[model samples]
Target: MMTALLLHGYASGIYSSRRIARAAVERADFMMIVAGDAPDFRTISEFRRRHLKALADLFVQVLKLAEKAGLVKLGHVALDGTKIKANASKHKAMSYD
Candidate 1:
């Protein structure tokens, strides 16, 4: 769903996220999700509010790791598209901001 919104330019909304999540579930096995079904709008909304900063920090850490691994070079473009999923449930998260 993040990929759908960020990369594929899908509009951000419950239905858009749900649609992407449901499709990924049908093609399962590689998808990492709790409940293995489309999440409710509240869940998705809360996740973004709670986890966006942490995820951004993680992304920076990944880039530093790549540089240390010699995978990053000046004047060259590279993007590692893999994402780690956090099992955020509505009951387990709080709004830290």
Candidate 2:
């Protein structure tokens, strides 16, 4: 349940422990994940500190799953108003003048 809350928070671009803790009480999605038992910021921070690596691994897994489900592509790129030399190759995106 806690993991679910944390993951949901991160996925929603809320990286602050205090924000996630507050969301657990205020946001419907977070409340559902926590089942009304909201953890305080300290608890969330401690969990994140202790399991930082594991959480990162899980996040990567989640992103992979999202990609597989066609929600996102792993390495999609977008260029805007940028000029690329016609001679540029894949190895060299752009050359410095």
Candidate 3:
């Protein structure tokens, strides 16, 4: 059950244990997955920490299966800290009286 929670969270683009814990309560899909037995953030974090390598291996295997079934096309994804200026107007700032 815990493994399912973590895997489902990862597949859904949720990596933080805190966010996972929140989703278990707020998201119907997650609630259904856990059968209403939601673990706390600390428990989730500790479980993840203790089984990090195993979890990573399981994720890779699942990805391979997905690629085999044509469910996902694997590709390189990269992110950089290229900052972009916000387009907000100067007038949007609050002024003190």
Best by lDDT: 3
Better of 1 and 2 by TM-score: 2
Cα-lDDT of candidate 2:
0.89
Better by lDDT, candidate 3 or 1: 3
For each candidate, the alpha-carbon lDDT, in order, equals 0.53, 0.89, 0.93
Backbone collision count in every prediction? Answer: 0, 0, 0
TM-score of 3: 0.74
Regions more than 4 Å wrong, model 3: 75-97
Q: RMSD (Cα, Å) of candidate 3?
A: 5.7
1-97 per-residue lDDT for model 1 (tens digits): 5423322213223344456555445545314433355555456556656877875676567667878899875366789999999979875786656
Q: What is the alpha-carbon lDDT for the whole of candidate 1?
A: 0.53
Clashing pairs in 1: none
In model 1, what is the error at residue 89, expressed in angstroms?
Answer: 57
**Model 2: colliding residue pairs:** none
lDDT of 3 by residue, 1-97 (tens): 8899998898899999999999999999999988998899999999989999998899899999999999999999998999999977767776565
Q: For candidate 2, write residues 1-97 as lDDT tens digits.
A: 7788888888899999999999998989898998999999999999999999998899899999999999987885887998765955756876575
